[model samples]
Target: MHVPDGFINAPVSAAAGVVAAGAVAVSLRGARKELDERTAPLAGLVAAFVFAVQMLNFPVAAGTSGHLLGGALAAILVGPYTGVLCIAVVLLMQGVLFADGGLTALGVNITDMAVVTVVVAYALFRGLVLVLPRKRGSVTVASFVAALVSVPAAAIAFTAIYAIGGTTDVPLGKVFTAMAGVHVLIGIGEAVITMLTVGAVIAVRPDLVHGARGLSAPLKLRVNGELVDAAPAAAPAATPVAARSPKKIWISGVVTALLLAGFVSFYASASPDGLEKVAADQGIDAKAEPHAAADSPLADYGVKDISDARLSGGLAGVIGVGATLAVGSGAFWAVRRRRHTDAGARA
Candidate 1:
């Protein structure tokens, strides 16, 4: 959920800002290990994809809707550290460009949505993958469970933060109950989206899916009436020209993201999302302040002075996808460059 300004006090918000900064710093270092030639570009694509999918909010309850949080999906496709950065990029873009989230409360949103969700989902996903059969399907299953849990975990995190710095005097129990309850329903949608996205990527390019790496069991051979592990296969003398290029998958992913955001987003549910609904019902928005960028041309996911709702929204969505891709790719490529620099220095 995107926490708007005025929901949390200045002190707590600043504290959360420090925490967010520290987490991002740590992720930048950690992402060095996760990013390279193959994954660095895909990381940006994953961010754009998440941004696109989040535009399509699905109905969860009669008046409540939910959208992909993208932590589990991103973490499964890329890696945990990169996943956090992906979400941070999306949140930043939404806040500054679309006025979807508040600028003052950026830290709170990053902490609750980006850091908490990625940490919880990736940890749970790895744990589940360890215990389950080491198969492609198991990665999909783990992605589902990890995503399902991450939504409520983020809700709990929000409730805890609100208890400490909530602007209103709403009862803590009511806030917790409402946030947790609605988000559980929302979690199912998150699970399904994460599962399908991870499954699709693993099917096409398991090597590109960080969570699915090493999932294929070692080849076995029958010898002396018993199956034995086959000797490791030697590396091929020459890499297949077709196998070396992820251009096809990358192009396909970009096209899919464009379609989802540019056109399909128009059909998404118009109802308020889980957090907005809970805030309105629980009186959590009593002190909510207007977004600083409310007057931006692209504010509210529509182009300024555009009378046609469909065209304005479509253009805004396209712009958002493009901006996110650009910013995210730049950030990830920098990280990748730093990784190579470090290696060169060491050598």
Candidate 2:
């Protein structure tokens, strides 16, 4: 959920900002090992795709809706550290460009949505992968479960944060109950989206999916009543024809993101999302302030002075996707370059 300004007091918000900054710093360092020539650009595409899918909010309850949080999906596709950065990029774009989230509460949104979700989802996913059968399907199953849990975990985290620095005097129990209850329903949507996305990627290019890697257990030979690891397979003379290029996947992803955001988003439910509904019902927005970028041309996912709702929203969505891709790609490319620089220095 994107926390808006004035929901949390200044001191607590500032503290959360520090925490968010520290987490981003740590993720940048960790991402060095995760990013490389092939996956770095793919990570950017993942971020843009998450940005697009988040626009298509599905109805959860009569008046409540939910959307993909993307932590589990990103983590399963790429890596955990990179997943956090992906979400951070999306949140930043939404806040500054679309005014979907508040600028003042950026830290709260990043900490709760980006850091907490990624950390919880990836940890649970890895744990489940270890216990389950090491198969491609197992990764999808683990992704579903991990995404399901991460939503409520983020809700709990928000509730805890509100208990400490809530602007209003709403009862802690009521806030917790409402947030947890609605988010659980929302979690199912998150799980399904995560499962389908991860499954699709695994089916096409399992090597590109970080969590699906090593799914095919190494061959072992039984010799003298003991099983020993078989000799490694030799490299082929040419790449297999079935193997898809990263460029193809990248282009396909961009097209899918554009379609989802540009047109499909128009059909998405217009109802408020889980957090907005809960906030309105629970009085969490009593002190909510207006977004700083409310007057931006692209604010509210619409182009300024555009009378046609469909065209305005479509153009805004396209712009958002393009901007997210550029910013995310630049950030990841820098991380990749830094990694190479470090290696060269060591050499």
Candidate 3:
């Protein structure tokens, strides 16, 4: 849920912004280590896919809607640090260009949505995967559980922040209850979407999935009456052929994201999302300020001067996908290039 400009006081918002900036800086370094031949390239696609799916806000309750927060999905598909970067990119795009989230509250949004969600979900996922069977299904299950919990965790984080610098005089306890209850429902939707997407990706190319890496069981052999780990096979000559066709996956993923944003989003619920609903009920947004970029050409996810609702929205969605993909991919590519350059220099 995007906090508007004045949801939190200036001091808290600025502090949150500092936190978000630090998290992004840390993630940039971590992503260099996480992104390899496969994951590095897929990082951009992960961000783009997240940005697109987030546009499809499905109804969760009577008047509350939820969408893919993308923390668990990205962490499961890629890695946690990269996941943070992906989400941060989406938040940046939404705030700066679409004016969906307030620019002043960018730090708050990033801290709650990007940092907290990614950290909590990935931790849960890793813990569950460790206990469960080392199978693709286990990964999916872990992803579901992780995503299910992450949403409420984010809601709680918001509540805590509001308690510190809320613009209204609402009781913190009441605010907590409402935020927790509604976000739990939203979390279920997040879990389902995350499970399906992660399952789909793992089914197609498990090797390409960063979270699934190193999870395959080693081969074993029965020697007489005892089972023993099989001897390692000699390495095959390095072939020039593509191990996995990343280009194909990238194109397919981009096309799918475009379709979801450009077409499927038209069917999204027209209700306020969980955060907005809760804020209204709790009076947390009594002092909410209008976004500074409300007059942007693509404000509110619609094209400027477009009277046709569907066309304007659809065009905006497509533009968002394109812009997010370009920026996210470019950032990831730069990181990847730096990693390669550093390696070469060391060599």
Candidate 4:
């Protein structure tokens, strides 16, 4: 959930900001190893995809609605380090461009949504994948479970953050219960979306998915008591291999993101999300300062003058996807560049 301003006091928000900055700094260094040649470009696509899917909030429980947090999905698609960076990129874009999350509370949001979700989800994902049967289906199963847990984990994280920085006098126990309960329902939605998206990507290009990398058992030939790798057979000279094209996948992902953001978002339940409703109902919203960018043209995820919800939402979603992709790509490219420089020095 995107934490708006005022839920946390200035001091706690500032402390969380420092923590968030440190985490981002660490992720940038770690991403150098994670976002390699093949996956660097895909990292941006993953962020854009996350930005898109987040727009389609599915109703859960009586009135609460949930959307993809994207930590598990991104980590499964790319690497965990890069995944955190990708989500960080999306949150930054949403906060600054769309006035969706609070600028003052940016650190809290990033720490809870990006750092906590990615770390916790990816850990569970790896543990399950390691123990499960070695098959492609296992990857999808692990993704679903990882995503399922991640949402609640994020809720818990936010609750804890609120406990520390909360400006109001609301009981911490109630806040924890409400946040966790609603988010558990949200977790189901997260699981489905994560499984479907991960399954779709795996179907087309398992190679591009970081988590699916070792799931495919190697082709082998039994020799004595051991198995040896099988030599790849040569293709016939006359047979032409299809050109590898990420263009199709990228275009499809972008289009899917657009549809989800622009049109689907309008139909998404108007009920306050798990976080928003909790803030208001639990008295956490008392201190919420108006978003710094409330006056921005794209504030509230709609065009200022646009009356049609569909058109306004669609334009906002499209812009979000484009901006996320651009920003994510630039961040990943810089990381890749540093990696190359380091490798060159080592060589």
Error of 2 at 105 (Å): 0.5
User: Which stretches of model 1 miss by more than 4 angstroms?
Assistant: 220-228, 234-239
lDDT of 1 at 228: 97
Which model, 2 or 4, shows the larger lDDT? 2
lDDT of each: 0.94, 0.93, 0.91, 0.89
Each candidate: RMSD:
1.6, 1.4, 1.8, 2.2
* Deviation of model 2 at 169, angstroms: 0.4
**Candidate structures ordered by lDDT, highest first:** 1, 2, 3, 4
* Tens-digit per-residue lDDT, 130-206, candidate 2: 99998999999999999999999999999999999999999999999999999999999999999998888888888
- Poorest lDDT segment (10 consecutive residues) of candidate 2: 235-244
- lDDT by residue (1-347, candidate 3, tens digit) is 98899899999999999999999999999998988777776899999899999999999889889888899898888899999999999999999999988898999999999999999999999999889988889999999999999999999999999999888999999999999998999999999999998999888889888778778777789999898999888988885555457777888999999998898988999999988998888788889998999999999899999999899989999999999999999999899889899999999
Off by over 4 Å in 2: 240-244
By TM-score, the better pick of 1 and 4 is: 1
lDDT (Cα, tens digit) per residue for candidate 1, span 248-331: 888899999999999999999999999999999989999999999999999999999999999999999999999999999999
What TM-score does candidate 2 reach?
0.97
lDDT at position 117, candidate 3? 97
